[model samples]
Structure formats: structure tokens, C-alpha cells
Target: MKLLTIENLVRKFSLKVLTGENQLQQTITQSRSHRPGLEFVGHFDFFPTERVQILGRKEITYLHKLSIEERQIRIGNIVKYHPPCFIVTAGQEGLTYLTQYCVEEGIPLLCTNEPQTTSEFITKLDAYMIKTLAPEIAIHGVCVNVYGMGILLRGKSGVGKSETAHTLIGRGHRLVADDIVVLKKLSPRTILGTHDGKTKEFLALRSVGLLNVVRLYGRKAFQDETRIALDIELTKWQKNSLNNELEHEPTFTEYMDVQIPHIEIQLQPGRDVAGLIEAAANNWLLKQQGYSAAEEFMKRLESDSSW
Candidate 1:
């Protein structure tokens, strides 16, 4: 698991430290922050003690409405529980309510002004945390963009993955990554594939050595990332190679728990592997639009009277 510090958070959002300067190293374990309306009303049963707490205008007003004794007891319960930090949104009054409690209790106190609203600021924080806490892993493959469909090309070394990518680039396709692809789960069903920014500028080809793809094919020949829409596994041709029969059932491979459409293309002497990959991308896009060439062929075959 990745841990975030108040130090990083302050830098990310340009937050102002009202207190707890020495506690900048404090870690934030939860992706979401908390606002204390319920806690001000003395509700503490389900309070998330580890989440960063936020104080907006409404929350500060709520604390002021309570008698000082009641407010102290209510807010005191929350501070004693020891949350990661307390953030008072800019333009909110009543810092005394949280600042004193945070300072005395050793909790970090912070404020931000750029995004003034509590809603917008919290949303921004949530977006960053969601991405930072997301599951990620690196895999061996060549990723490319053909016909706007992101394709992940996989095969054993020397099986022509790079060579196929090279051909695709020549045919005006963008190469996302070569050799190493980083896969991140943006959501349950969305797997985003990205490449090293510097490394993506070059394509390593056997014997020919590393070719500068960006220079050779110009700027449009490369992309930093693409959503992995389909996967293609290339293999050396053999007598027992996968049959060319139409697949009525879909095939898939799991990456970050996302089931991406997958297909296997056998490599043969003088065969066009790049063209096949392009066709596979086109086929996948067509399937997404509810049109399948294989299904059409099957329907025609079944409609025929001849056995």
C-alpha cells in the first residue's frame, strides 16, 4: 500500500499550515477526508479516526451555534480520537474551534485558498487519492493505437512483437509502449495502459538495434498512453496452431481484474502480422458497435440448405 504524508499533500494542493508544522510528516491512510457536522452534534460511533478532517464554513458555524461547553465536549471527542489532520477551507471563520484542539492534540492543521469551495476542494483531493491508491502493475508487452483502439501486443521474445509495432507505426499507427507497459485500474472495468515517456520515443528492434521512432516517423508516430481495448498474442506457426475457425464466443485476458478482448495470431514466413493486428483492432471496435463479421458469416452458413 502507498502512504501519503501531510508534506506531500501540502505540496500537491499548496495548503497553508496553520499549525502542526513539526507534524508535516504525518501520514494520511484514508483516501477520503471528513467534515465534522455529525461529530459536532456528538455523534462519534462511526467516526473515521484516521481520515483527514476538513472544516468548511458550515461546520465552523455549527460549532459556534453550540454552547462553548457543549462545543468543547463535542469537538474534544473528535480531537482525542486522533485523526490524521484538520483542514479549514479558506474563507471559513472560527479557526479557534479546530486550531487550538489540533495544536494541543498534536494533529496537523492546514488551509487552502486556490479552490475555495469545500465541495470542489474535497473533490480534487478525492481524485488524487483515488489515483494514488489505485492498483497498479507492470507487464511485458507492446502497446499501440490503431484506428483509435488501444491494442496490447504480447508474445515471447523474438516472436516479432516489436517488428509488428514497427510495421504498424509505418502504417500511421501510434506506439504507446514497447517491452514494458504499466497497467493501472482506473475503475473496475477500465484498465489504462501507459508507457515510459522517454522510452516510448524509441523502439528496440532485433539486429537493427534501437531505432528512434519519433524521429523516424515524426511526432504523430507515438503516444504516451492508451486504454487497453484489446490484446493480441502472437506465436510461431506450427501444425497445431490455433484453428482459423470463427469465434462465436469471446476470448479475454485479465489485467488489473479487467477482462480485455484477446486473440492469438500465428507468425509465419512472409505473413503480414501488423495488418492482422490492425484488422483485430477493427474487429473489436465493430463488435463493440454490435456488428460482428463472424456472427454474420455464421448466420449465412446456418441459413443455407446445403449440409
Candidate 2:
């Protein structure tokens, strides 16, 4: 979604302008080309140089106290500042200079009952801007929220990524994204996971055709978004001469500049893949809480030597 524009701001906050229609129109036309829907507040006029002249309550009062020519100079100086809008709080105080300048320049002036309310309104506007402006990236995998941790499953076409996700779903995990995972960088190190709008709930279940998970499992059984914490890869075992090591516990691997805590489970003839995945999720939880089974075993061995 695009961010709110000056017109949107006026409509949302219900602001009443005291000056500058011509200026407002010109500024809106020019800013729309760049910001599109950026919301503006208060009453202001647009200068020829594409700047807005704001007429605040204090300035209006000052204009009332000054001579006619002095008031014109004040409004001119304000236009030179090139503000996008002018805000006159509370009610009208007969600041004819400000009103005339706004009428001539066509800038928007906004009036509101309370300043604090306006502050909150602007805060929400900023939040909306950030969410809409964030960069988005897509990855080929299925993401699920299992026991409050984001788990991403990746492998070859027939390597059972969706099947594993289904298994996890059946085991009471919440599905986030099915086939294509949309990842957004929320922070420097944190990546938030979501699905593209087109495929948010659509999942391919081999023989079952397309299935709507939300329709089947209810909304609570799935999350609209989550932060990706780990990645699991499934690979077919090759009986070649290489590093052959017995699987002791879960391990990790990295990909695409992300330290995706990974585990390559070799799919064999008679392995309980679903159960293994559950155990992997539990192991990840333990690791996150600083409990390592390998480290515990080493500690036990050292203690036994003293005995």
C-alpha cells in the first residue's frame, strides 16, 4: 500500500484549513508525482518555488498586531521558508494577512481541536509509512510457527517440504506460508516471514489438490506473520565415499547471507521423518533456552572421571 497523501490527511484528521487553496493544489500536484499519497495537515499556501507557507495561530496574531505592509512581509517570509502546510489551532482570530496570503497562494491551512490528538495521528501515519516502504524478498519454502518459533523447511521438489509442513500442521503447529515465503527485513538481524497476498492460504497437497488451510484448520491454527528463526533442509542420502558420521543430534547450516540454523536430515528408506522433525523443533527450543544435550553429556563425563 502507498503512504497517505495531503488530501488523505485532511480527510482522516478532519482538519479545517484557514488559507492557501491555490498553493495547496499546486503542491499536491507536484508532491503527488513523488510521494503520491503523503498526508498533509494544517492550512498553508504554495509558493511558485514549490514551497508551502504555513500560518500558525501565533503568526496570525502577530499579523493582526503589525501594519498592513509589515503583515505582508511576514507572510512573504513564511512563504520563503516553503512549508507544505500551515496549521491554525483552535478557532479563527481574524488574521486577515494569513487568510489573504492563503487565498492568493492556494496553500492548505489546517485547524484542529487538540494538538495531542494530532501528534498521535502523525505517529500512526509514520507506522503505516514504514510498513508500506519496507523491502520484500521471496524464498521457495514452507514456513510454520511451531511452539512459538519460526521454522522454514527447504529441499528438492519431491523432498517433502510441503509434506513436512503438513506433518507439523497436523502436530498442532501454525502454518505461516506454504510454497513461496515472503520475507521482510524488520531490523538489521531480524527477518519477518509472511506470504504473498495471492498465496497466503493456498497450499498444494499432492493428491488432495489445492487446499485452503484457514478454511480447514480455522484461523488460530495459522499465523498471518512470524519471524523466521531456523531453516531445515531435507536431502537424499548418497552412498559415496565421503565424510560419513553418525547422526548424534540436530546441526545447523547457513544460506543466502542468513545464519539460518539448519539441519540436513538424510531421507532414507525407513525413517520417521515427521517424528524427527518434531524432535528437531523441540531441540531448537532447548538450544534457544541455552540447554545443549551435547554440552550436558560432556559435563556428565567430566564429573564421572572424578568418581
Candidate 3:
């Protein structure tokens, strides 16, 4: 789990501070935001106390309908829950009483200038939180989104991982990460990959020190991140080993607790490694759609006894 703090939200949105400056250090554990409509109506059942409380135009209007004394009591009761923070969107005014209540309870009150409606604010904030708080882990690999499939190139150092990824980019695929790929668990079974912030859009070849992938191949050569769909491991060609034989069942590698389809490629001089990788990606896509050429060939071979 990643750390999401009120301070992070403030910095990302440039929210105006109304009060509770001391509470900026508070953390938000859930990747969801609540609108507090039910809470405002005194319905405390199932209130997401761990999420950021968003007070949008509709909620504020409802508060304005009440007398000052009533509004203060209702808002004060919510503040007592000590939510991670309170975000007032649409830059609405007349929230002084709410601000005072938050200050009294030491709850961070933040306001955004965007003209988004109440529902819009909730949806956007929820999305932002989900992305920022997703579980992440880093690994040594090259990730590329080829034909709408994410292919992760992994192996020992100097095993032509970078060179193969570079070639795939020349074949019109987008490079997601090079050298260091950060994997984020977006859901129970999905993992997203991206380059390290400092090393994005850069690749290292054996002879070449570093090359700007985006600059050399244009902006289309770069992808911020992609859901990892397959893992390809490159290995030095073994003289007599048939490790990549079609008779062998496909294997998988555990990444962030998720099993990714894995393929081992034997590297050798005069071999079209780039083309082979591209074919592997295409074959993975076929398997995803419930088609397997190897299985089909075996079935046909069993059906026909002609030598």
C-alpha cells in the first residue's frame, strides 16, 4: 500500500486552505472518497470514515437551507468523525461555519477552484486516489505495449533485453519502461507496469550509453504505463537444449503475486530475436482470445494418421 496524505492532495490540486493546517499530515488509507450526503442527513450507517469527505455544491446548498445553529451542529457532528480531510469543490463560498467547525476539530478543510459538479468531483477524486494508492513493486525488466498487449522483457543482465525492447519499438510498439519497471497491482489479478520516474523514456544498449527513446522514435514510442500481460525471458542459446520446444507446456512467472504468462527465448547470432518476440506477443494475444496454434496442431496430428 502507498501513502496518501492530505498534504499530497493539497499539493496535487493546489487547494486553498481554510483551516486545520496541523491536520495536513493525516493519512488516507482507502482509495475512495465519500460525499457525506447521508452523514449530513444524520445517517451515520456505513460512513466511510477513512476516506476523504467531499462537500460539493449540493451538500453545501442543503447545509445553507438550515439555520446557522442547525448547520453548525450537523457539520460539527461529521467533523467529530475525524475523516482524513474535507474537500469543498466548485469554489463555493459561505462555508465559513464549516471551516470554523473543522478548525475547532482540527480537520483539514480544502477547496478546489474547478467548476466540477458534486458528482464529478467525487468521481475524479476517487479515480485519483485509486491510482495514487495502488500497491507497487519494482523489477529489472523492459516493458512494451505491443499490439495492445503489454510484454515484459526480463532476464539476466546483458541478455539482450534492452536490445530486443529497442527493436520492438522500431517495429511500431510503444515502450512502457526500460531497465527498471515499476509494477502496480491495480486489482486482484491485474498488474500495471511503468518506468521509474527518473529513467523514463531512456534505454541503454550494449555499445550505446543511453538513448532517448521518445526523441529518437517520436512521442508514439513512449507509454506512461500498461497492464502487464506477458513476460518474455531471454537466455543465451544452449547448444543441445530444447527448452523452447512446442511439446513443452507454457509456463508462468509470479509477479506481485499475480501469475503472468512466461516464455523463454534462446538468444543466438543470426537469429531474428525481435521478430520472434513480436510473434510471441501475437501468440499471447491469440491465447487470450481462446485460440492456441500449438494445441490445434496437436489435435490435428492426433486425428490424422497419415505419415
Candidate 4:
């Protein structure tokens, strides 16, 4: 399992480090955030010290109402658990007691760049951590956004997967990634596809060297990420190749255990591979609307038995 370090968190959230600058490299163990409201008043039965501790205006105001000794002692007890870090939300700062205890324990103390409430910041932080820490696997495929559908072009090497995808870009489609696509399983059924940042906006061609996608196609043809909706494989047309057009009942395949609609196209000279992929994306959209072209064709054949 990958962990989110506090240093990256600060950079991501634009957080201002209030204290414990030396412990900025601490890694967050989970996406869950702790308010520690009960722990402030001597209620520490099931305190989750591994989680990121948060303090909002409500908690800060409540602490201010307490006596100096009571506040310092309670904070000391909570800091003894050594949480991954502390986030003071709602723009509240200048906490002498909490800062002292956190610095003594070497816990990174961070504040939001904006004045968002604890609930709001927690919601955003939770989403970020869940996505940033999600397990990912990079597969050898070209990801393209065809007619608003994410289509993964995959097959054996030299099958024109990248070439077909580049042609699709010329057809006004967006390119999510080329050559290598990083797929992160956001959930059991949802997988998002993106490219590695270093090699972004570039494509490799067999005949030509690396082509900058953004330079050739401009920014409209580039996309950072897209939710994968369909997967297509392109294989060289051999003599023993099977015709997939004969029978199609919504084929499917998996990436990182998440299933998506699948199609296999036989690549041959003079074949309109890019157009076929665009059609596949359109067909996938029609399936989402409770319509299947293959099913409709079969119905027509059964009704008009003039064959």
C-alpha cells in the first residue's frame, strides 16, 4: 500500500506549515481524519493516533474555554499517541498549547491555504488521499477519448495501436495517454486512466521518432485523465484470424480486476482503424442507453426470414 507523505500533502494542498517543520516527511497512513473533540475533555478510549488529527474553530473555541492546565494536559495526552500530523482548519491559528505539544512530539502541524471549514477541508482531503494513495498499475496501451468515451487501444507490439490512436487524434478526439497508460482502480468497478507526468503529451511512432502531441494537435487534443469506459485490442490480420463481426454479444475484459466492454479489431492494410474505434466508442454509448446494435440486428434477421 502506498502512503501519502506530509511533504507532498503540503505541496498539494498549499498548506502552511505552522510547526514541526522537521517532520514534514511523515507519511499519512489512511484517508480518514480525526477531530479529537472527545479526546480534548479526557475522553480517550479509542483514539485513532495513526490518522491525521484535525482542529476546527469549534474545537479551538472549546479549548479556549478550558483552564490553562486542563488544556495543556489534555493536549499532551493526545500528542503522546504521535499522530501522523495535525491540520488546523477554518483559518484559526496562533495556538500556544497545541503547538507546544505537537512540536515536542515532532508532529507536522499544517493549516489550510484557505479558510475552509474542518468539514469542507476534511471532505477535500479525504478525496485527495483516497485517489492519491489508490493502488495503480501501468499497462502497455494507448488511451484515447473518443466521442467522450475512454477507449483503451491495446494489442501485441507492431499492431498499429499507437498509429491508430494518433489517427484518431487527427479526427478531433482527445488523447489521454500514448504507449504507456497508468490505470488506477478508484473502486471495484471504476478505473481511471492517465499518463505519467514526465512523458505526457507525446507519442511514439514506428516510422517517425517521438511526436509531441500538444505541439502537433494543440492543447485541445490533450487530456490529463479520463475514466476508462471501453477496451479494444488490435491484432494483425493473419490467415487464421477469426471474424469478430459474425457474433457480438457485448464482450468484456478486465484491467486491475475492473471489467469494461471489450472489442477486438483485425488490423490490415487499408483498414479504417481509427474510424472503427470511433464507432466502437459510439456503440458503447448506445449500449449504456439500453440499446445494442448486434441485438437489434439479430431481431431484424429473425423477423424478416427472407434469407
Candidate 5:
């Protein structure tokens, strides 16, 4: 696992570090080799040597109850602790001495403006941390990386996601995974999709059996990892279902507290599903940069008022 530094945290949250600029940056930038000790206190952990330490307003008061020497010792241990960085919730300011110690020792302090209880803050922060720190794995399925966007194909057995992926592959797009895709929630708002290393470069065609796609299609046809930008599901058409009036616009699928753009392409006789999927992918790419063809068409029709 790559330990994230405090400087990166500051950049990520757009926070202003009030003190200990130089030291905090240096301490957080270093790699963490071991896990920190955990001492649970009021929905927060007082880890002696973890890279990240969380401080609440009440926790700071609790620390003040200890002798000056003891407080110094504890703060020193945390400053030198090696998990990655420290996060302060609810914008609670620590004791002046503790803040001074943190500045001198170069320990990064992160503060959030969210006004929630300690437990709720911990739960949400932990979720965000896990997404940021978890490892990514790849699985079997057709993974398409189109113009910097990752589009995953998913559905029941024999749904045309894989076949559509193969078609995209033939059309000069890149593949990230085939069959099983290991998706990791990177943050509350982001999911990182990557190819499982042990099974990367492999795709199982329905009739042709397992094939080494990297070996057959060369390096350009495959990618080691990608951020899951969208999801497309291939489903059988239902006669009673209402078709989406918005063409070439992708929908979003929410999983594990993250929202990923997605689309459902109905499979039916005489429909060129592969071509539609490709067009969908292209249209999705355009939408990411604030262009929506369906919305544009509707705007034109509304403006004309004759159609």
C-alpha cells in the first residue's frame, strides 16, 4: 500500500495549514513501514505511531487532563508515528501545546468542516480512507478504456458485454479486464478499476475458450488499470418497457456509496447492439466534458417549436 502524505491531503481537501508547515509536510511525505497502535477513545483512536491520528475537541480536553510531561510524550510518539498522516474532524482545534508540537515535529493535521457526531464522523471518514487505501483487483469481463474513461460491461450469464468488448477491441479501443473485474472504491466519490494481475491479459470467449488477449492483440489493446468511469449493461428487451428518450446519454449506477455513470442497452433481434454500444461509449466520453447530444437535440427541437 502506498501511504498518502499530508501535503497530498492538503491538496485534496483544499485546506490551509495554520501551523507546522515545513515539519508536517516532511513527516507526512515519508513512507510508513508499520501499523500504529490503536487506543479507542470516544469514537476516535489514539494510535501512538499510526501515520494518521484523529483529534476531536473533546479528545483534546481529555489530553489536557494528563500531566504536561505525559502529554508531551504522547504527542511526540504520534508525531513520529508512521501510518501516513493525521485527520482532525469537525474542525476541532487541539491544545496550543499539541498544535505547536505538531508544527515542530512536521506532523500533518487535517481538519474537516463536516458537523457530525464523533461516531458518524469516524464512520464516514473510515469509509473514505478505505476507498483511498484499498488495493485494486481485475476480473473477467470486457473492460473498455475510451478516451480516458473506463467503461465496464456487466450482466447475467451470456449477456453480450464480453462480445461487445471484443467488438470495441477490434475497433481500436483498449481493454482493462475481461469476465471478472475487480473494482475498488477509491474514495466516497471515486472508484478505481484495474485488471487483476494474476488474470490480466486473459479473456474467455464463449466458443473459442480462453485466449491471451495481450499476446494476441499486442500491448495497445490492453491496460493494466483504469478508473471505472461508466458501466453499461446488456439486457434483453421487454415489450412493455419504455425506451429512454435520451439517446447517446449514459445513466449512473450507485454501488457501495459511489456513483458510476451507466447505460442499459436492450438486446433484441435486428438491433446492431455492438454498434450502439460503441456509439454509446463515444457519446459518454463527450458528456464527461459537458456535452450531451440528447440534451442538445432536445434544446434544438424546443427552440424550433415546430417539430
Candidate 6:
């Protein structure tokens, strides 16, 4: 239900407002663009009016070949559809007819530099719109992609979250974010995690200062982004407490209205915390595949006569 407005695009791409300044508040629902060749030819079948109409060299050339009256009638038919906006890529000339019509009809007409080709603009703008429209939130955690699963490790400060993530990266898993993770709700159930520019490929280690994960471990040590599948919280180890019970059931955390599988691990001395995190990730993957060791164990105990 998120909306991307023409004004937002203008600010992001530095677009020139050829016309329809009042219609800058118009919203676009899709991330795709239409060439509008068929619409220009009076063929409205399968026309995507919800997306922006991109006029590149080919479409403008086609219109230039037509008589003024014919071109007006052709382009006029397209204007009747009330598209979100019309973008002229490469700053092509001879768009006065289109621009005037759009201005009079209150349709947004935008122009960009010649170096920005139609395809390049569409691809980049589409991606930007998708990300911009997604619901996002910031989380203090370390996210890593382990065994193709996105694991978000969160805890209080000095809880060994970053150390475990660093260890995981050294073990060949890829780091998605170090301290602050940005989570975008792409769908009702899917959450995508990414980091900001400043701390993307860098991890802050207490003993060694900032470590560039990509440079230290090569490209395989970092992932630009990932879809978060599990959440783990690290806490101090307790002696003979219920929190330390091995028979405790798994937990769930609600994030952006989505229920994520959660785990709580105790931090202690002489413990292989990194390996434990790896095992938790593997167990989460197993549970996703309908394999649960806890449930199997309970079923076996019930079927045994000695139980």
C-alpha cells in the first residue's frame, strides 16, 4: 500500500520538470514503465496505465514520422488513459507536442540527461521506487547469511553479538550488517535486511578496531542484503535457572506484524558461542523443512513402553 510520488522521483533522479508542476504529487503504484508505442498507435490493449510512460528515441522517432494531426490524435489517445507520468529520456527533442498536451491535461512530463538512456532510467528508477515504497525500520543487531538463511543476532551492548557474527563470517558465512540493520517489510511475511553506507562492510571489533570484512575475507564474506528468517538474542549465562533449561520451548518475536522464529542463547566463558550460533541456524533451516528434533524426541518417548 506504500506510494511513490512524482516529487520523490524528481528529488532522487534530479529530473527536469518539463510540465505538470501541479501534478508532482501524483502517485505511482508499480515500479515498471510503459513504452506507450501501442497506446500511441491507438491500441490500448494490455496498456499499463498505472506505470510511468517512458518516451525514448524510438517512440519519439515514430511520432516524428507521422503528420502533426495524426501524431496529435495518436498521442491524444494515450493521454486519455491518465497515466501517472510521462518521462522523456535522453532529453530528446521534438517532444513539444507531447509536453504541451501533458501540460494542458495536467499530466506530469519529465526529462533527464541524454546519458541516462531509457532502459537505464527505467531499471534504476524501478528499483529505487520498490525500495522507497517498502515499509522499513531500524534494528540494533548483527545480521548474517548462514546456510542460505538470514539470522539476526541481537542483544544488549557487550553481549558478544558482533564477535559471534565475526566468527560466523570467518567460518565462510556472509555478513549482512554489523551493528545497525535496516529491515524493510517487502511483503506481509517477508522482511529484507540491509545496512547503511557507513557501516556496511565494516565490523567494529573491541581488540582490533574496525575490520573490513570484505577486504579481510574477500567478497564472499559480505552480502549486500538478505531476507531475515530468524532472530537470536544473546544473554549472560545463568546458573541452574529456567532460562538455561535445555527442554525450554522455542520462542517467537513479532516484527512488523510478522512472527519470526526466535532463540535465546546464554553467553559464557570457554563456550564455543560461534559454533552454537551456527548450529542454531542449521536447526532453524531444519525446522523450515518440517524436521524438528524436539518433536521427534517427544513422539519417540510416547511410543516407548519404558517411558
TM-score of 3: 0.88
Residues 35-146, candidate 4, lDDT per residue (tens digit)? 9988987888888888888889998888888898888887887888889998888888568878888788888888887867788889988878877877799889899888
Error of 6 at 10 (Å): 9.7
The best-first sequence of candidates by TM-score reads 3, 4, 1, 6, 2, 5
Q: Whole-model lDDT for model 4 versus the true structure?
A: 0.85
* Overall lDDT per candidate, in order of appearance: 0.84, 0.64, 0.86, 0.85, 0.66, 0.86
Per-candidate total of colliding backbone pairs: 0, 31, 0, 0, 20, 0
| lDDT (C-alpha) at residue 252 in model 3 | 91
Residue-level lDDT of model 2, residues 68-147, one tens digit each, is 77667656665544456655543546756666665665556666555544335445444444444455678888888887
Model 6 TM-score, 2 decimals: 0.70
User: Among these predicted structures, which one has the highest TM-score?
Assistant: 3
Model 2 misplaced stretches (Cα beyond 4 Å): 1-127, 239-258
Pick the winner on TM-score between candidates 5 and 6: 6
Global Cα lDDT for candidate 6: 0.86
On residues 191-235, what C-alpha lDDT tens digit does candidate 5 reach at each position? 777665666887777888887777888888888778887777888
Local accuracy of candidate 3 as per-residue lDDT tens digits, 1-307: 5788889888887788888888788888999888888888789989889888888778888999999889877887788888888899977888888878887888888999766777776777787888789888889989999988888999999899988888888989988888899998877889889877888899889898898998898999999989888888899999988654565576899877899988888999999988988888888788779988878988899889675
Model 6 residue 283 lDDT? Answer: 80
For model 4 the local lDDT of residue 36 reads 93
Error of 2 at 276 (Å): 2.8
Q: What is the TM-score of each candidate against the true structure?
A: 0.79, 0.62, 0.88, 0.86, 0.56, 0.70
For candidate 1, write residues 1-307 as lDDT tens digits. 2578889889999998888999999777777878877777778788888888888888877778888889888888888988888888857766786688888998888888684688889988887776666677888889899998789999998899999999999999998898988787878888878775557677899999998888888999998777889888998998774676777477899986789988888999999888888878887788789997877987898889566
Stretches off by above 4 angstroms in model 6 are 1-51, 54-74, 77-82, 87-128, 242-250, 302-307
Candidate 4 off by > 4 Å: 1-3, 37-47, 238-247, 294-307
Higher-TM-score candidate of 1 and 3: 3
